[model samples]
Target: MTTSTPAGHARVAADAPHGPAGGRTALVFSGQGNQWLGMGRDLMAREPSVRAVLETADDVLLGATGWSLLGELAASEGESQLADPAVLQPTLVALQIALAGLLAERGLVADHFVGHSLGEIAAAAAAGALDLPEALHLARLRGELMRKAVGTGRTALLGVDAERAEALIAVYGGGADVAAWNAPEATLVAGDAGTVEAVVAELTGREVFARTLPGDIAFHSRFLEPLRTEFTEAARGLLVPRPTSGRVVSTVTGTLLEGGTDSDYWAANLREPVRFVQAVDTLLELGCRTFVEIGPHPTLGPSLTDCCAHRGVTPLVLPTLRRGEGEQENVLRTLWELRRTGAVRAAAPAGGHRVRFLTAVTAETPPPALRGRQAQFAARAAAKALTALGAAVPGDGAATATVTWDSTDDLAPEAASVVAAPVAPGADTAAVYARTPGTDWLRLATARPGTGTVPTLPDPAELTARCTARRYVADTAVASAAQDADDVLVRLRPGTGTGRRAHLELAVRITAAVLGAHAPIELCDVTGYDDTVAGDRVHVARMADGTARTTVLDAAGRPLLHIARSAWRTRHTAADPVTAPAPAAAGTTEAAALDLDALRAADPATRLTLLTDWVREAAAAMLRTGVDRVPALKPLNRLGVDSVIGLELRRRVAAVFGAEISVVRLLRGATPADLAADLDDWLTDTPDAGPGTAPVCSAPGAVGPGPDLDDPADIERLLDDLDALSPEEVDSLLGRLADDAASEI
Candidate 1:
């Protein structure tokens, strides 16, 4: 297989046998170093099969480790967890197994299975020789044991042939061993720190490129001996490899494992070098023409490609999913390519096949109105459509344009057209449909096709209301109402009663639907008679000005409620919440209130304690509980502190600390403890935080309202910032401005 466009189908050789989904393909699982953040997340969301597999593995790993596997995958942290043997090993296996299961569900089956290092477990599971739960448990134990083993470093040597690579290791390896034969020109070595360094230094002296791999675990070397005994004993109970339809070529032995891979075999697999080249060659010898990496990302693709290249033959190589690319798109693209290649032919499950029918359905009538010709044309078109739909045409009652399907073996067309005989507007076809219960459906357009363009109205968020009741109702109902160009109609649900409040809310909802906004509404002027109840259709006509007049009508067409000039002022200025007055000079009382230098000059530990207390207090305020109720170590979110509350807490923290804190950090930190730790570290490290140092604001986008408010430049700058405020923020700014103006008056 060759690389295709981002959205292009996977490409296979024209002559290859159709692989599984109908093409011949082999599944290869990558070892560690292939996992990354956001891996499999998109796929899990898009594909039900993939989600099922991942969710199942999540439960299994969570049960074994008391941590969520999916959570780790989605976390924003870097490769720290991936470096942990206990975490990375199980996660890699889980990702690979899930990808394999996803493909199988889409009708793709692997002809051969191959895995590198820890990936062997995933491959074994894919071949049906090992149970998933058993594999997960074994992977976790293996990782944990290996982590406990004594080792320090691992490195890969490049630009050296296989012979020279082995010779260099034998000569200067010190205590390190060749861990993996990744490619003919690339070899991985692992051992204690000094030995690994010695090998790298010697290789550099010899002019052969060498670099240390990520993480310090000396996998596949003598360092893992400590794990072998424990791993073997544990595997004896869980590693029960049974017969499988697909073959699993062993990288440890450089050949196929006969009968089945036993517990002892898995134990040794941890300490042996991965002979990936030989395994690839063995798979080719077994007639495998396509190689697909079944993991989060493709780390083995280059190595396997080199292996095939060395054999002087080209093989189809693909990855199940790659970083940055959507998982479902990649799978679908590959499947499309595989179908094109004929390695596998697409086939649907029994009774799941579907056929769809569509018609262009032109509408036209001339003065002549040749009824006979029209009928003949309609019949001919219907027949052609039925043939295209793979549906049987009616013989005796052909005048009805009928299609038929057998209920047992054959099912109805997945898509069927619902057509109605043309009728005048407002024609009551309801009675006719009531009589014939099986009628599919029909739609009637009241206006003629060539009618004048419909007038339009501003969305509900645009206009302001004059009546308070109307405004309140409008704001609440705007989200649920149905509005067209010139009119708005809202169907009150069954629960709203004929009480005074309900009637007022309905009037507001109707008025808001017509005028758009709820604020600045003047509702006290209007008086109501009877209340409106549920099932009433509230209609509002959009007036030329921004305001609207509303009427609530009962089912019988009698007016239930009315409002005169219910909508608000036509040209109201929206509030600007974010705008703030220019800051007074440096010594202003507001600026002096939050003096952080004294706090910073205090002992670091005392400062940290105080800061922690502040966080607790802020969290309590956000949760609307007493400070004693806040959990200092738990994440604030777990205590029902929402975003609004979190923002308020952030504001409080900024005011008290007189330091700018990152909103991102505030949101992403694992818990209050994490936030407190970060703040403490920052305070301790910041040199300017000491006494006698001039204070500076560090909060993002908060350089504002400084002590030089009278300066023209400061005033201009403040206004510029205000211009960037969102509509909600602007509204808040306007409210603050109104309060300040009232104080002055």
Candidate 2:
């Protein structure tokens, strides 16, 4: 059968032997340096298939390392251990495998698979060359071995061809070698730290773009040779040779896997240089045109584009997930792109039997009595109905009950009936349905029997050690002890109110703050709620499954309400377009004209007052709060100004007043009054300077010591820090530095 293809794509026979579009689809997996703290979280909450894969991986990793893989992924930015190779390697592999599984379930199966560096293990698993458990084991062992070599060497990416990279490495010949040939102009060099740094310095001096990769260990180089024997022996016990279901492009050998992967092959994969460009060539030769990157982010898209461009072909490159973007949206977009390009056949609807149940109040139309905890009550009603239908009841162990809210609408309070039915004839999961009295039943939520054991919670003292517990309102509904950015413990105080909606809302707000979720709550799974009392504490921890678990405990610390998962729904609309504001011309606006002469003539006390008022109003605008609410003495972060907001405030200051305030100072407990004092000092010291003059401290004690520019490592660290700043902040900083240098001259 033949089908029409989208414009710019070629049509192909649907029944082709290689694939749905005759070897046009390939799944690419990226290795390290692409992972972030909250990757794969939304998929775990929305896709049951992805959750199952993650759960299986967590089980395998926990048994092997006595640490939960899910726990690490859900860690707060401040508490994250993702930078450690021992943790990151397995985590990336697990996430990649989960993404591949999700894509396959969506009918976007690939005809070929390729992986970069450590990503090959996941690619092998996805290609059916190795079982999931064995693949995870191999990844874990690889990470452990790699961790031992940390700090011994470093890796650097230089904008040069492989030949040029080799020549440069030879110039500083201290064991540095070409690690990976990413593209015609992108080559990775790695070896001893000093040698690599010397090479980077030389290239940088010659204006060639050279950057040191994040991790300290030099992967795919002789620095890893010491680990070969141990890694091979360990891998030998876990990996069994098996044929791949799909063609596996080998980066290490730069060829197709003719037989299969074994212990020695894995050993070579660890130590040998990566021939990524060659692997891309092999895929191109096989006529693969659509590349889907299955990893945390689109780290390989540019390289893939570059490699394809070299062959005079423009391939469609898609990313399964992107850093700081919605995972569900990204994956769905990729799937759509695949179907659009005719690389995957269109999916047919699979109709199935669904069980439904009645509820007192659905999430969409919750009554006043069940306002905030609608999902909790709805799940309870559904579980009872499922039990009546002979479904398995969730036990009070580590296992949990899964609940999802389908819709939201305000309806009159009633004893709303629910229809409970199994998702499949004998499936453990069941769907709950509800409707208004005269309307058809709408799917409300799904309940699934949870597997595995619950994690142990920290002691109350330990949990509250670094946290400041505060009530949601001035003393009204709920008090929460936010432990870092990913965990919160809430205590339901007595005599607050009869309604529990406030408590639930407070918990949701705190959860959103920690998880950085801006979506509305749509579904929640509750467990361990057999009994409860006033003053019971609710502990909510962000999970790797892209949800937060709320565990209610009594004063003595017994579990009362265990909400295993709370899912959020983000509303996307094409009508609501975000357009950037046009840049203002220099000195064109009245606000930009700072009266330097008037400011220099004013007294110190008056200047401080003027600066303080300006700072307060600017902060209020950025914080989206009333100026009255922003106290002059309180720190900006204390008034809900996070790192992102703090950067915006800095940009505003730079744009309007032509002054650069340090973001580190803004977020690290600096008050508006403190900033005003700094501005006053700058005005007093640089009286003859214009508005854009470099910032100067009247007192030497105003700023902290600067980094030593002579030290390359320190310079690198400074540059990394600067990279996090906004473009305006960088411009302001450079202007200030330039003005300072001119004044010295």
Candidate 3:
């Protein structure tokens, strides 16, 4: 399908089928040169159908080749026999067949099937022309015969059309022949090794790009003629053909297979060039507009697209898997695309588990008036919604209910409407929305069946130790706190009364601190407050939708309260003002005491400890937190320090320690301990420099020196210099100025 953008929104043209009832769909089986190590392993582990097919193939091949198909696929690169033709060919066929079975299970049934080169055997078996065993036997025999063929041929792909490739072969006067036409500008040629090498060298001289395929076997070339007789004889003994249940397009003859194949047909398939483009044209003529390539990787997609494009059609082409990517994710993406394009129908299970959508309340049916505060009203509203939707209410005890609010606007204790619907087809969960009477409905909450019992709580000490190891600052308000990645767990301060609103506000603040967010919190979901327990632990997990889910658990691990979803409103207020230190006088004992020379003269261990302590104290001052709470090894950003604050900290370091450090370095995920170590290293390597000896000027709006202190511009400069002077320096200067004034008097 073609993708276009109109009005800044992507639009995919569904020119093919709208659903299974619409246009026909075809399954395109891929051939060789696409296999990789660890291919199809994910599928084998996740899909029972795939695993069954692979295990069956392994059993089948063991008796025939005395080697395990599963073992070969699991082998590391160096130990793998996947490069062997005898192993790779059958392995590819088995994988393709397994993928087809998987698609069929997922409600995507093929109306027709096609294969390129060795893939034809799998296509035939899938179309019911041959039994699986017969097809697998043919694959084994074919691989064995091809591997035993006596030939010294090689193959290479060229960035040229089939016609130019033929011309080059003719001009070179070699025995090379075109093996396959891949795309409008891509072609494959095969010949004896020396001739193919010379042809590639000649193309390189012309600045034409060409790449030689790995291995020495020239498939779909005349080099396999020696095995033709033996393959035909072996196939004749195993031949037992029947009418296919589905259509099978042939790449050998480039048309639909009219009848069952014979030994001679199999022999011709072995020694003939792959007419992939022509077969694609036949599929297009037969009204198939959606093609799903079944293989470990997409080796035929480019060719299929090129062929379809030549006919002025942009057919929907999808691959079952790709190399160097997660196979399960790729397969799911393909399935999702197919369903989105209406090529497959999402099927529900046999039983009627689907929840019905609740109709919106009409003007005639006025809602009940709300009573009490938001928290109390919300609980009653949720119970009413569950009853209206014919759902069972969560029982008291360890049961919990999740409530999500779409808007943070305070709901008045007046008339309000509650509408509910199922989250998805065949889902047990229901989403409920609440709004003022006579207004549009927006989702406000969702409730699912709760667990009958409580879940075990994680060890608080273990979590605390992990937090300390990661150098995360703990919230003092929280009795004990810990963090793992984006998840934060904090115990409520003991003796705090169990107030729902108060607990929610505390949880939101903790989440905001860890996220480094300054915006107001929007409540998305809250759960389990029917039996509010004092001293509950709040656990907040960051969600993929930029929201956090906060759950409050009691000491016994039962969920006492839960906020299913909460998010920042994206509008930020001005930060709290930072308290600046009083100006220190320059050239005084106090200023000299803060110099780096003293730190440098100390032993390495003591120096590191001193610097680390200094860093912690400075960071704490900047963050407006307790010095004990500042983590020595935690990243500055994780400790809620941003760029502006980092710059201020950098200036403070220069002023206090007489060292200049960049703001970028302070904010690049470096911890207080790391910065201390770096400073220690710098002090050790650098000699005593007097450039940073002067204390920084701290007067507000102060500038540098000017021509005269009497001038308005120079007055600010004089004030700045005075601010930089030590207490003793200031006293001495004041005495001298007083004496001069007395003499003038």
Single out the weakest 10-residue window by summed lDDT for candidate 3.
363-372
Q: Write the per-residue lDDT of candidate 1 for residues 1-745, one digit (tens) a residue.
A: 1111112112233444322223356789888777777787777654555667778988999987987788877777653476677888888888788888766655565678889988989998988888889888878988888767644556555556556655666676457777777876777777767767776787788887888766667878777776677777887867565885548888887667677777778888887777777777677666667788888777887787776666555566777787765566566445534543455433443466311000100111110111112222222222232233222222211111121111111101212232332134453211101111344432211111111122232233232221123211112122234544545665554444464345544565445324434222222122233443343556676556555556555544444544444324211122211111122454444225444566567777666666676577557544434354576777666776654455555455555544444343344443565666656665666745532332332223334433434455744555579656433333234334444555964
Per-model CA lDDT versus the true structure: 0.55, 0.65, 0.63
Per-residue lDDT tens digits for candidate 3, residues 1-745, read: 0111112112122364322334668899888778899998877854666888999999998998899989987899889988677888888888888887777655565779998888988998878787767778888888888777546588999888778888777777757887876666777889877767777888888999888887787777778777788889988868687886439988887778888887787787788877777677777766777888988888887788777777666577888888966575466556645654555444422353221101111111111111012333354455444433343323344344344444544444235676677777867677767777667766765656554344343455555555542222223234555667656677665544355444544555555534434333344334444345664676766665567666666676555555555555321112221121222344444235466777788888778888888788678655644354687888888887875566567556656655544444454587888778766766776656434653322222323322322344544454579756543334333434444555963
Higher lDDT: candidate 1 or 3? 3
lDDT of 1: 0.55
In candidate 2 the C-alpha lDDT for residue 66 amounts to 86
Clashes of 3: 8
Candidate 2 residue runs with Cα over 4 Å from true position: 1-23, 347-745
Sliding window of 10 residues with minimal summed lDDT for model 2: 354-363
Summarize candidate 2's per-residue lDDT along 214-324 as a digit string, tens digits.
Answer: 778887888788889888888876867898744899998766787788899998989998888888877877788778898898889899988777766657677888787
What is the Å distance of residue 501 in model 2 from its true position? 12
